[model samples]
Target: MTILGFSPGEWFLLVQHELLLFAAFFFLIGAIDELAVDFSWLWLKATGRAGAPPLDSAITQKDRLSGDAAILIPTWEEEQVIEQTVSHMLKVWPQRELRIYVGCYPNDPATMSAAMAAAAGDTRVRIVIHDKQGPTTKADCLNRLYRALCEDESRQGRSAQIVVLHDAEDLVDPAALPLLDEALHCADFVQLPVVPLPQSGSHWIAGHYCEEFAESHGKAMVVRDAVGAALPAAGVGCAIARPILRDLAKTNANAAPFDADALTEDYELGLKVAEMGGQSRFLRLRDGDGRLIATRSYFPATLDAAVRQKTRWLHGIAFQGWEHMGWGTTTGDAWMRLRDRRGPIGALLLAIAYLLLALAGLTFTLEFVGVLPAIELSGGLKLLLWINLAMLLWRAAWRFGFTRSIYGWKQGVMAVLRIPVANIIAIMAARRAITAYLRSFAGVVPTWDKTAHDRHPSSFPSALDAELRFAPLEAKR
Candidate 1:
C-alpha cells in the first residue's frame, strides 16, 4: 500500500496537484507572451498599418527592369521536381536580365540532367555543380551558387542587383520577382508571404503548415516589422540586396555570405542583415485581380516526413540558434528572438498539458468508482485554468481567422481540429531536435536533411495558371 513512504492514493494526489500547478503556471506565461503579439497585431490592423500594399498598375516592364535579379535554387536529389520548378519559373518570370542559378551536386547527375533538360539551351538558366560531393548542407550548395553568380558577374562585367533564394519545389508567383526587385530599392531584405498548398491525402499532416504560415506571416510578421524587430526570412519568396550580401560575405574573408554550417541559413540571413543596420521588410502585395503575390509549395505530406522537416527546423532555430546567435541588444529584437527559440520549451509544456488531460480523466473515473477521494482545487489554480481557457479560445479564433482568410471556411474549421495534430508533431520534433543538437557536441557534422518532394505546384493543372499566363510564347518548354 506504500511506495517511497507514501500511500498510492497520496502519491496520486501529490502528482495531480504538482502537474496541475506546473502546467497552469507555464501555460499562463505562454498565454501572456502570445497575447502580447496578438494585441500588437490587432493594434496594427486597427490602425490600417497591416493591410497589403497596392500594386502599381501603371508600372511598366521597363520600370521593373531597373537591374538584374539572380534566383538561386539549391538541390541535392531534387530531380523529380527540379525540372518542373525550373520550367515554371522560366515561364512565369519574363525579366530578360533575370538569371536562374540552380546549384547541383556533381554526384547528383540525374538532377543535373533534369535541370539541363528543363533549361533546353535557354541562356537564362545556369546549373552550377558543387565541387564537393552530395548531401552537403543546403547553405553550402547555396554558397556554391553564390560563387557561380560572382564568376558570371566577373565574366559578363554586370552584377545582379539582388539575389533571390528559392527551393527547387517552389512555384513562384510571376509578380513576386518584380515586386522583390521593387522592394529592394528601399529595403535591404524583402520576404513575401509563403502560401503552403494543401495536399490531397495529407490534409492533417500538411495542412497545419498552411494554418501556421497564414497566422505567422499574416499577423506575427506584420507586427515584427512594425515594431522594428528582425524579420526572419522564409527562405523561399525572399530577396536580399546584392550590396548587403557582398558586405556580409566580406566579413567572412569573402568565402561565403551565408553561414554554410548553419541549418537555417535563410532565417539567419535576415537577422544578420538587421544586426548590421540593414533594413528588412516582410512585403505582402496583391495584384489587380487580388491574388496574393506569394510563393506556393507543398510541404511534407507524411507524419514521419513532417516530423523530420520540423526536427531540422527546431534543431536549427531553437537549439543551434540559441548557441550561435545570442540574445539581441534591444528589447524588441530580444523579444522576437526569444519567441523564435521557445520551440523546445513550448513542446515540453504541451506534452505536460496533454498528460494532465489524460490524468484528469483517470482521476474522475477513479473518484466515480470510489477508489480515490475528490481533490479540491485551489482558488488561484482555478483562476489560472479559466484564464488559460479564455486564452485558448482567443488563440483558436486567430487560427480560424487566419486560415479562413487564406484557404476559406472549410479549411479554417479543419485548422481548429488540427491543433492537436500540430501539437503532437511539435512534441515529436522537439524530442528529435534535442537529441540531434546534443549529438553536435560530439563533432557530428550536420548534413542536409532535405525533404523529398514528388509533387510540384505545376503538377496541378490550375495551380499558378494565372501567373503562367504572363509567360512569353518562347518560354514554353
Candidate 2:
C-alpha cells in the first residue's frame, strides 16, 4: 500500500504491472484453448476430415418443403427496413413450405404498416401484434411470434418442423433454405455464419464488426462446433426445431419460449436447448456454385450506435448470462462460459495496460530531461512482460488470419492494426454494460435498448437484394 523513494509516475506503473500480470494469466488460459481449436481445425481441414454432416436425405429430396419451417422476425420501430426484410424473405425462401411470422406491437403502427405493406397480399406472411405496448424487449416480441406460430399451426391443422430466426436488416440467401432443411434432420438448433457488409463511411465504427465477426464465425465458432458445445445464436441466421421450441415454451410460465427479461434471449435459448440434451450446430456450408451460404447485413455505422449495440451484447453475455445460465458441469463448458463472462474484467485489464503505456511514455520523457529517476524493471518482471507481449502478438496474428480469410488481405491487415480500436471499444462497451446492468438490478426495469438499422446499400449492387426487391412483387402479382 505504501512505497518509499518512488515517484508518483513510478508508483502508477508498478501497480499497473501487477494488475496486468494478474489479468494476463486468465487471458493466457483462453488464448491457449483458442489456439488449440484453431490448430485442430487446420489439421482437420488439411486431412480432409472436417465434421461434415450427412446429406443422404437432403441431397435426394427434390422439392424444398414449405410447411417444414417458418421464419420469425421481430420488429419495433423498424419501419425503415421491415417491409424490405419481409419481402426479401418472401423472395428467397421456399414459397410452398415456408411461412413467415413477423412480430409487431399494437402501439407501433408504422412498423405494422410497413410489415403489412411488404406482405402485400402474400398469404405466407402473418403479422402477429403483441398485446403489450411498444419496445418491451426483443424476447417479448419473439414470445408473441411463438404464440402466433402455435395458433397458426392449430388453425391450419399442420405443424412446422423448424422455426428460423432473423432480424429486420437481413439479406437472406435463397440457397439457405435447403441447407436449413437438411441441417434440421439431425440438429435441434442450427446457426449459420453472419457476414457483415462493409461500411464505406464508418471504417472505424461499423467496419470493425466485419473484423470481429470474421474471426468469431470463421475460427471461434468452428472451435465450438468441433468441441460440441451449444452454439450461441448470432440472433440472425439461426434455426430452431419447432417441437423443441414448443417444449421450451411449455416449460416457461408464460409459454414464451424466449425469456422476456433476458437481454440476449437468443443466446439463452441455445444453452437451454443444450441443457435439454438437444443437438445445437454451427455449420459453414456451400451452395452448388461454391459460394458460402450466409446471412448478410450491416452493423450500426456511428460510434455511439456501435457502442450501444456492443453494450447490450456484453451485458447479456457477461452479466445476464451469469445470473441466468449456471456454470456447466463439464470442464469444456466451464471454460467456454468463463470466456463468455470475462468482458468486464478483460476491459479492466486492457484499460490498465493502456494506462501503463501512457505512463511509460511520460516517464521516459521526464527521465530523459533529468526531472525524474530512470524507471527500471526487475529481471523477473522483464521476462514476464516479454511473455505477455509475445502472447499478444500471437492473438493478433490469429485474428488477422481469420479476418483476412473472410475480408481479403487489406481488411485483414487493417484488422490487425485496429487492435487498439477494438480494445478501446471493449473498454467503453464494458463500462456501459456495467452501468446498464447495475441500473437493471436496482429495479430500473430492463427495456429494449434498440439499435438503429440502415438498409443494405443499393449502390453495392447485390444481386440478392435486387431479387428481394422485385421478385416478391412479381410473385405476388
Candidate 3:
C-alpha cells in the first residue's frame, strides 16, 4: 500500500527515522541535565560538605536537642496506622519537651479514637479535631494543627522552637526529631532523608520507591543544598522553625501559613520558606550505631495504589507547581524548577522510546523476511544514541550503588531489574496527571488522593526488637 507517492517500506523507514531523531534529541538533552546534577553531587562530596557528622547514640539526643519541638500529624482516614505510628513514636522518643498534635476531622471518629488510644493519657499527644466535617486537603488539616500549636503557646506562655510536619502513616526515627532540632539552630527549614521500607508482599511495585528515594535523597538533595537551591520537603520527615512558620503566616495576613488548596502543601511550604530568605537544609545523618537517622515508611504496595499516589505527585509538582510557583529569578531556582517539572516530559520520552523499541523489533523481523528494506542510521544520530547509552549506564550504576548502601546488594540488583517497572509507572502516572490537570479547567476541584496504608514498620519483628534494644539508651531523665 502506497500513499503520497511513497511505498509502504519507504513510509516505514521514514517513520522510524523521524521517531528515532525525535526521541534521541530530547533524551540527549535530558542526559546532560542529569549529568549536571551528578557532577554537583560529586563536587559536594569531594569538598567534604555533603552532610553532618554522625551523632553519638551513647549521648542521649533528647538532652542535646536545642529546644521544644511540636510534631504535627495530619490525617483524613488513617486510623489503621495512626495508633501504631503514634505509639511507636512516643515509646521511642521519650523526650519531655516533645509534643505531638494530631489533626483529625470531626467525622473521623475511628482515627481520632485511634490517636487518643495511642496517646493513652500522655500529655504530649494533643488530638485536634477540625471543625469541618471530613476529607479537606492535608494542608488545611495541618493549618488547624498549626493554630492549635499557637493557642497552646498562648496558654503555656512558651513556644515550640520548631514545627515538624508528618503524616499519620510515617514511622518516625527516634533520632530524627533531635537531629531536626539541632539543625534548626542554623536552618529555617530542614528535611531529613526518607527511606521507604521494602514491602514483603509487593517487591516490584513498592520496592521501586526504595530505589528512587535512595538516589534522590542521597545524592540529588545533597546537590540541591550545596548549590543553594530550595529543598522540597518529603513532607513526613521535615521540620520548619516555628518562627519561620509564624512569619509565613504573617505573610498570608496572619492566617495559618499552609496553602489549603495546594495538593502538595509540604513541598510548597519548603520552597516558600526559601523564597522568603530562610535557609533550607537537607540533613543526612546517622547514629553511632550505624543506623540512618531518617524517617522510614511503607509506600503503596499495589500497582493501582502506586500509580494513584504518583499521579497525585506529578499533578501537583509538575502541573500545579508550575502554575503556582513559576520560575524564580535566580539561576539556581530556575534550574531546580526545571528539574522538578521534568516528570511529565520524561514520562513522555519513555513512552516514545518504548514505541520505538517495538517498531525496531517489527522492522528487524520484516527486513529478515525481505518484506522491508534496511535503513542506515545517520552518523549524528548514532553519536547521540551512544552518548545517551553511556548516561543510562552511569545512571544505573549510581542507582545500584545508592540502593545497595541503603538496602543490600540483593536489593541493589533488584533496583536495576525494576528500572523498567519504575519507568512504566512514571508513564502511567504522567498520563493520569495530564488528564487530571486538564479536568481542572472544567472546575474540577482537586481533593486529596490519599494513598491507603495497611502495613506499618512497627509490625515487623526487627523494628520491635531494635526499639527494645535502644530503650535503655533513650532519654535518661
Of candidate 1, the 10-residue stretch with the lowest lDDT total is: 468-477
Q: Taking the tens digit of each residue's C-alpha lDDT, what string does model 3 give over 61-86?
A: 55645677899999988889999999
Misplaced by over 4 Å in model 3 are 56-59, 464-477
> Which prediction has more favorable TM-score, 2 or 3?
3
The candidate maximizing lDDT is 1
Q: List the residue pairs that clash in candidate 2.
A: 65-97, 66-97, 66-98, 67-97
Model 3 residue 462 CA deviation in Å: 1.5
Model 3: what TM-score? 0.94
Error of 3 at 141 (Å): 0.9
lDDT of 2 by residue, 189-253 (tens): 99988977666666677777877887778777877777777677888889988889888888889
- Could you say which candidate leads in TM-score? 1
Give the lDDT of residue 417 in candidate 1.
95
The lDDT of each candidate is: 0.87, 0.78, 0.86
Candidates sorted by TM-score, descending order? 1, 3, 2
RMSD of 1: 3.8
Residue 346 local lDDT, model 3: 96
Candidate 1 clashing pairs, residues 3+ apart or interchain: none
lDDT of 1 at 15: 90
